[model samples]
Target: MKANVWHGKNKLQVDNVPDPTILNPRDAILKITSTAICGSDLHLLDGYVPTMEKGDILGHEFMGEVVELGSAVTNLKIGDRVVVPFTISCGHCLSCEEKLYSLCENSNPNAWMAEKMWGHSPAGIFGYSHLTGGYAGGQAEYVRVPYADVGCFKVPNDMSDDQVLFLSDILPTGWMAAENCSIEPGDVVAIWGCGPVGLFAIQSAFVQGAERVIAIDRFPERLRMAKKLRAETLNYEEVSVLEALKQLTGGRGPDACIDAVGMEAHGVGMVGAYDTIKQAVRMESDRPIALREAMMACRNGGTVSVPGVYGGLIDKVPFGSVMNRSLTIKTGQTHVQRYMQPLLERIQKGEIDTTCIITHHLPLDEAPHGYDLFKNKQDECIKVVLKP
Candidate 1:
């Protein structure tokens, strides 16, 4: 099998690796058909996560055909097409029953990590680091499916992989981000980072009845996408984000704000991993730059949702700036399974089309190229899907 590995800082390479085999009773094997590169992958590429090794497999979002199943796996059978959630979860956990799948006890059960929250704390993720349950990634010809019954969601035979690929991460992330906002009809939402997550956050906000969504990012291409969605796009390079945010909401900041840009923010120039994030806090710059801005831009008594990943300790939080505002802050990794089925139904009904975010489709071996394009934001590349 071939895969893209993160050799070091700003480096990626395609390499041949061993194929995966069924390892657990709940596991399944998938002949990967489509997989996506996400903003999260960039974090690993830049060494933001500690456990990513020299040859970590590098994809998470994917929809593929099941090739085999473990003895205990019953929900999914061979030949079924499914969209896999980036988070590994067990449906029988307390959290899973409550629909808080991200905190599923069987997977993580009590673990704070995404994989464990879903199922088998030992059930590693596809392409994340060892610390993240180091399950092999799907950025290859074949991937081993762990906790099959609790992980992959069976897609309708009529649906296209491209249309539902994001269900694995970003689309549901957007829905989770929106849910964090607690927005009411006619509410205003401001999203930082126009990347796919933020873009979906914008659309999802609209779907959730946000009357206006203001998108913030430095990229012209992303801003253009925001414009296409009728979201008011603001280039952070052009104006003071705080001032602009204030202006957009008629002197009141947006009712809700979401930070889709996580640890690898725009300004710090890929400042290493979660452990090194504390260094960012000491600087004058915002730790989670987007998160802080979103908090600062949130209306008094409103909410600020951070679907973006944030780690490391902070020295400065701009809390003083947002103080006296009685703001509510909501954040965490997306409870992907919670939204998967509902969003899948929406996709089946044509209420949302997330495929527009996918710009490059390449063979599994081209994973490095896809990363370069996505990381550099070049050729207007937003999402890249790898076919194995």
Candidate 2:
């Protein structure tokens, strides 16, 4: 099988790799039918992550068919079409029982982290690096799914791949982001970063009953998507986001703020989107922009939710702003399993077309092309799925 391998900073290689077989009684082998690149993958691609040994497979978001299942894997069967959650977890762990699958204690020991927790380090990641669980990912022809019974969800046969694929990651992550905001029916929410996750957060906000959603980003296509979805958009290029938001909100700010940009936010410090902050905390920062914006725009005591991924830290956050505003901060990766059934129901009801975000599709052998387009934001690409 050929997989997208992260060789180094700004370097990706399509390499032939070995196929996977069931390694545990709870595991299954999946034939990756469709896979997409995520922003977190960029961290590894740009060398922002550590211990990325050469030839590490480089993808996490995907859906596939079960080719083989271990004897103990009772919830799934061979020939079942399923979407694999990015987090590899044992179903019975304390965290897993609580639906915090990302924090599962028995998560793949051989996958990413041998000595850390989900909120810390590269504990368990797919094909990106060795610091993560060192697990080969779905960018290839075959992947070994650890904790298969709990990790893979069967995709409805009538649904398209794009329809159910995001249930693997973004849909749930966006839900996590929106839920963090504690949105009320009449609340207005502001989101920074128009990436797929950010877009999902915007949609999720509406689903959660936010009356107004203000999506902030510099990208034209993404901003347009926000408008089409009936949300207000801040270009961050045309006018001052905070000032404009404050003016629009009657000087109070949004009711809830979400930072989907994470550490990748551009033009920090409000000096215009071009002025980079002196230093950035290299971890999840729905804070830098959304937190600050929310403090200034949210109606005093609004909530701030962060579903963006972050790691290895530095720099001090403006804790005072958040404290003075009495802002609530919610942050985490999606506990996808818990939200899957509900989200699937929504999809079945024609609520949101999650697959509409897919801007490109390529053969699994062209995994490199998908990565290039998605990494550079080229081709107006928001998401690119590789098909086997």
Give each model's whole-structure lDDT.
0.78, 0.76
lDDT by residue for model 1 (52-160), tens: 6777777888888999899998777789998898877767767677777665555532233433222234323567776556667888778887778878888887778
Clashes of 1: 16
**Residue 201's C-alpha lDDT in candidate 2?**
87
Tens digit of per-residue lDDT, candidate 2, span 270-353: 111112222332434342354455455666788878776664433445678778878777887677788888999988988867
The TM-score obtained by model 2 is 0.90
Count of backbone clashes for each model? 16, 15
Best of the candidates, lDDT: 1
For model 1, what is the C-alpha lDDT against the true structure?
0.78
The C-alpha stretches of model 2 lying farther than 4 A from their native spots are: 108-123, 266-296
